[model samples]
Target: MELSVVVVNYNVRYFLEQCLVSVFAAIKGIEGEVWVVDNASTDGSVEMVKLKFPQVKLISNQTNLGFSKANNQAIKLAKGRYTLLLNPDTVVQEDTFRECINFMDTHPDAGGLTVKMIDGKGRYLPESKRGFPSPWASFCKIFGLTSLFPKSKLFAHYYLGHLDKNATHEIEIMPGAFMFLRSEVLKQVGLLDEQFFMYGEDIDLSYRILQHGYKNYYYPKCQIIHYKGESTKKGSLNYVIVFYKAMILFAQKHFSKQKQNHFVTMIKLAVAIRATASIIKRLIIKVWLPVTDFALMFLGAYLLIPWWEQFRHGVTNIYPRDILYALIGFYLLTWIMSLWLYGAYDKPQNLKSGAKGILYGTIAILVVYSILPQNFRFSRAIILILSAWSSLSITLNRILASTFIEGLLKWNARKKSVCFIGTASELKGSEELLIQAGFHRNNITHLLPEEVLDEHQRAKKEIIADAIKYKNISEIIFGTEGIPMTSIIHAMMYLSEFDIDFKIALHGGDSIVGSSSVEAQGELYTLEVIPLAKPVARRQKRIFDILSSALIIVLFPILWIFLVKPLMVFKSALQVFKGEKTWIGYNHPNISKQNSVLKPSVYLYSKWGKGLTSTVGLDFYYAQHFSITLEVSELIRNIFKTQD
Candidate 1:
C-alpha cells in the first residue's frame, strides 16, 4: 500500500466525520488504508464510523488510551509503505497525499514529513516547522522569549520562526497533528514511546529519526486545516501539567544524565509557573465581571446611604454604624446572589438577563424589607434609586467592555455577518444548520460556485473581497460537498489576510466546526440539542431544584407521620440543595457521567415502565424536554418511591 492513515479519535465525532471525509477524498485513487482507533468515545464516534465509513479498519478501545498508546496500536497494524498519524480534528486537501508521496519518493533520506498547517481561522501554525527542543529552545519557549522574538534565530529556535513558512525546509520536529512517517523508519526506530503520553512523542520520535541519520522535511505545498484541541481542553491546568510532564519524560528517555537533570528541573519549574498562571487566569475570567459588578453596586449603595440620611433625616450618620454597614452589605449580597442565580453573567453582552435579574432582585429586596424589623428598615425610595443605578451602571459596563476589551469580555452584540460559499443546495442546508445551531440568519450572504469562479472555474479573489467590503462578513463557512478540499485550502491561504473566522460544514452532517486561534479549543455547532445546555434552561432548572428542595425540607416534618423513610427524604432534599444530587437526573450512570447536565438523582422512574431501559429513556426525554412541570410531576410520582 502507498499510505496508511491512522486517526485516534476521542469524543469529537463531528470533527472526525469531516476529517474522514477529507481523508477519503484525498486518497480517492491512491493505495491507502484508513484506520480509526476510537478510545471509548461516548459521543457516538464509533457508531458514526461504523455507519458512514464501513471500509475503515476500526479498533474500539473500552477506555481512553492516551495519544501514544492509541497511535502505537494502529502503527503496529499498518501495512502501507508510509504511515500518517493524523488528528481527527484536521482536514487534508485532495492533492495532499499525492504531493507528500511524491516528495517522500524523491527524498530517500527523508524519514518523516509534516506539511504546513493552518488553524481553523486560517492562521499559520508556527509549530508546523519547529527546531528540536533543546535546553535553550525549551527555556526560550517557556519564558515567552520565542513569542517576543519570533523571527530571531537565537530566541525563536523553538518554532524556527525565522524560516519562510511557504517553502519546504528540513526540520527536526513534526507535529503529532499531521506526522507522515516512512514505514521503514518506524520499523527501525520503533513505534511512539508510550511513556511520553500526549505531547512530546512527536519530538522524541523526530529526534530519534535525526539521530539515525535521516532527515525530516517540512513541506508547505500540501496544507491542511487543524482545528486544534478538539479532544482535550487547551485552556485547562491539566493541559499545562500534562504537556510539560511529557517534555520531562522525553528528557528522561533521551537526554544525557547531566542534561536530563537540567531539563527535568527546568520543565518542572515551567510546569509550576504555567499551571499557576492557568489557575489564576481561569479564576480571573470566571469572577472578574461579578466582582467588578458587586464592587460598583456596593459603592453606589454606600454613597446612597449617606445621601439618604442627609436628605431624609436632615442629619448625617443618623443610622447606627453596625446597622448601616450590615444592611448595605446584606442588601448587596442578596442582589448579587439573585443576579447570579438568574444567569446575568452567563452570556456575553446579554444585558437583558442582567436587567431581568436586577428587576427580580429589586422585588426580592422589597420582600425582605417588609419582613425586617422597623429599626432595620431603610428608605424604600433609596432602594428604587439604587436599583436604577445598578441597572444603568451594569449595562454601561458591559457596553464599554464589549467595545474596548480585546479578549474574553469582547463580544459583538450585533448579529454576526456570515458568508456561505458553496452550491445552492449546500447553501440552503448550511442555513438550516446555522439556525439549528443558534446562529442569527439575518445577515447571511450566499456566494454560489458560479459567482465565485471564473470561466475557467478558477476561484476569483475579488468575489470574497467584494463580499467582505459590502456585507462586513465576519464569518465564512465552506461546505465540503460543494467545494473540493483543494479549493478550501486555496481559499484559506488567499483569504488569510482578512479578519474572518473560517468554519467547515460537512456536506451531510449536522455540525459546523471551527477554532478562532491555535490555542483555542475547537468549537462545534451541532443539531443535537440538549435542552439543559441553554443558559436560561439551566437557570430555570436550578431555580426548580432550589425551590423544590426547600419545599421538601419544609414538608418533611409534616410527612413524618405518613412516611416510611422521612429522614431519607430530608437527606435527599439536603443533597439536592447542596448540589450533591438532583431530584430528577439521568437514571443510567454511564449517560450521567458523560456531559448529561443532570446530577445523580435520588429517584429514577418514568411514566412508561419500571425497567432499567425505561429509566434511561426517561433521562433522555428529560434532557431533551426539560421543564419545571415535568420535573415537578416526576418528583410527585417518585417521592414516595424513593427507596426503589
Candidate 2:
C-alpha cells in the first residue's frame, strides 16, 4: 500500500461519516487503504461500517483503550509506505491528499507534515504549526499575552505566529490532525508513547521523530478541515476535568519542576480571582436586592391599605372586633398563598423577565380572595393596594434577577467548546460566522483530517472512539458536500444511541425536508428537530407548559372549594326551589305533557343540626328518557350542519 489512513472513532458517527466520505472522494485514484480502529462505540458505529462500507477494514475493540494505544494497534497492522493520522470529524478537498503525498515524496528529509486547517465556516484554524511548549511559552499562553502581542516577535514566538503561512517551514510541532509521517521515520523513532492517552501523545511522537534527525514540515499547500474538540463540548464536566488532567500529564512529562510549579500557581491564582469576584457579585444581587424589595413591599402594603380604607369607608372602625380579626386573617392567608403560588421567594435573582411572574402573583391573590367567605372580605381598597404593591415588588425583583442570571449564563457559556469537521476553507468560514454569532474563540477545538488515526484499518471507528475518550465533544458538526445519504443515516443512528446531538452542515443543495421526526420513549418524547427550523418556538412551548401546569396545581384546592363548588351547589338549590324536580330538563308547554315526559320524586335531607325537610325532585327513569332524546337530537344536528 502507498499510504495508511488511521482514524480512532468515539461516538461522533455523523461527523465521522462525512469525514470518511470526503476522504474517499479525495483519494479516489490514490493507492491507499483506510484503517478504522473502533474504541467500543455504543453508537453502533462498527455496525454502520459493516453494513455500509465493506471495502474498509475495521478493528473493533471491546473497550475504549486510549487514543495512542488504539492508534498504535492500527499502525502495527498497516502495510503502507507512509501513515496519516486523521480526525474522523474532518474533510479534505480533492487535491489535498495528492498534494501531501507529492510534498512528502519531494522532501525526503521531512519526517512529518501537517496541512493548513480550516473550520466549518471556511476560516483558517491556527493549528498550522506550533513551537515546543516551554515554561515561558506556556505561561504566556496561560495569561493570554501571546495573542495580546501577536505582532511582537518575542510574544508571537510562543505560538510560532511569526512563521509565514504561504511557505512550508520546519517547526517544533504540527497539530495531530494532519500529522503525515514516513514509515521509515516511524521505524527510527519507534511507535508512539501510549503513556500520554490524548493531548501529549502527538507531541511526544513529533519530538521523537525530530530526535531521530528528521525535520517536521508545516506545509500549507495541502489543506484539510479539522473539527476540533468534539468530545469535550457535550457538557460533561468530567471530560473537561480529564482534558485538563491530560495537559498536566503532558507538562509533568516535558516541563522542569520549576516551570510546572509556576503554571500550577498561575492556574490557582486565576481560579481564585474568578471565584472571589463571582461570590461578591452573587451577594449583591441575590441576597441584598430580594431582602430590600420584600421589606419595601411589606411597608408599602401596611401603609397604603390603611390609608385607602380610611378614604373609601370614611368610618374604618365600623366593623366589629370579630370581623376585623377575620379580615386580618384573610389578608395574611391571601398574602402567604400569593407568595407560594407565584414563586415569589424563589431566588428572585434567577427569575425570567416579562409579565409571567407578575401575572401569576395577581392570579394567586384573585383566586384566594374569591374562595374566602364574604364575612371575611376586606374593602376593595385593600385588594387594590396589595395588587399594586406585589406587582411592582415582583417586577423589580425580576429585573435584578435578570441582570445577575444573564451574567452568570454568559460566564457559563464561555466555558463550552465546539468543534467543526470539514475542509480548511470551510472551517475558516465557519469560525468567522461563529465569532460574528458570539462564539468565543477560546472555546473552539479543531480536529483536522490529518490528526485522525491513519494506520488503523477502522479509521472511522478509531476517530469516533478517540473523540469520546480524549476530547470533550459535546456536539459534532459535519461540513461537507456530496456526502452519501446512507452514511449520513448510519451516522445519525449511531449518535442517537449515545444521546449525542449531531448536526449536518447544509451547503446549499437540494433541501432536506421531512427528515425530522419524534422518537417516543414512554411518556417522554425525544423530538428530533430538523437543523433548518428555528429553535425559539419549541423552547417557548416548553416554558408555557411548565408555567401553566404549576399555576393550575397551586390554585386547584382554593378555587375548587370556594368558587366552583358554591356556584354548583347554588344552581342545584335554585332548580329545586323553582319546582323543577328534574336536575336537567326543558320546561314544557303543558303541565300534563311535562308530567308524561318527566315524572317528579320527593326526598328528605338535613343540614348541620337542622331538622329534615322533604324536597321534590325529578324521577330518574323519566329524566333519563328526555335527556337521551335531547342528546340524540343534538348529535343529529351536529352531524348534518356544516357550521357550528
How high is each candidate's TM-score?
Answer: 0.85, 0.52
lDDT of 1 at 526: 49
Q: Model 1 Cα RMSD, Å?
A: 5.0
* Model 1 C-alpha lDDT per residue in residues 1-644, reported as the tens digit of each score: 99999999998888899999999999989999999999988777887888789999999999988899999999998999999999999999888999999999999999999999988878888989999899999999999999999999999999999999999999999999999999999999989988876888899999999999999999999999988878788767998898888888888888999999999999899988888887887677677678888888988977877888888999888778888688777777877877786666764335676788789889998998999999988578878888998888887776665553334342432478888888778878777557655467787888887777777455787888789888889888887765787777778778879868888888877568887777677666643444465676667877888888898788877776665567887898899899888787666554554443466778763644334356555655666667777878777766665434
Q: For residue 355, what is the lDDT in candidate 1?
A: 83
**Model 2 weakest 10-residue run by lDDT:** 519-528
User: Which lDDT tens digits does candidate 2 get at residues 1-644?
Assistant: 78888988886554566567667776688899898888887655676567556877899999988888888998999888889888776666666778888988999889999977654433456666787766567666656778898645577665588788767889988777778889878888888778867666777788778878899988887666555655334223344345445556767766689988776666556445545665676566556544665566567656775566578777555455577556544554555444433334442212332234445555665677688788756655566666667667766655555564532221232444555655566566556445533357876666554453244311253565457557665555555443332233334434443444444553431111111112110010001111101122222323333443344345545544543344543443344334454223322222222222222321111121223232111222222222223433432232222223
**C-alpha positional error of residue 345 in candidate 2 after TM-score superposition, expressed in Å:** 17
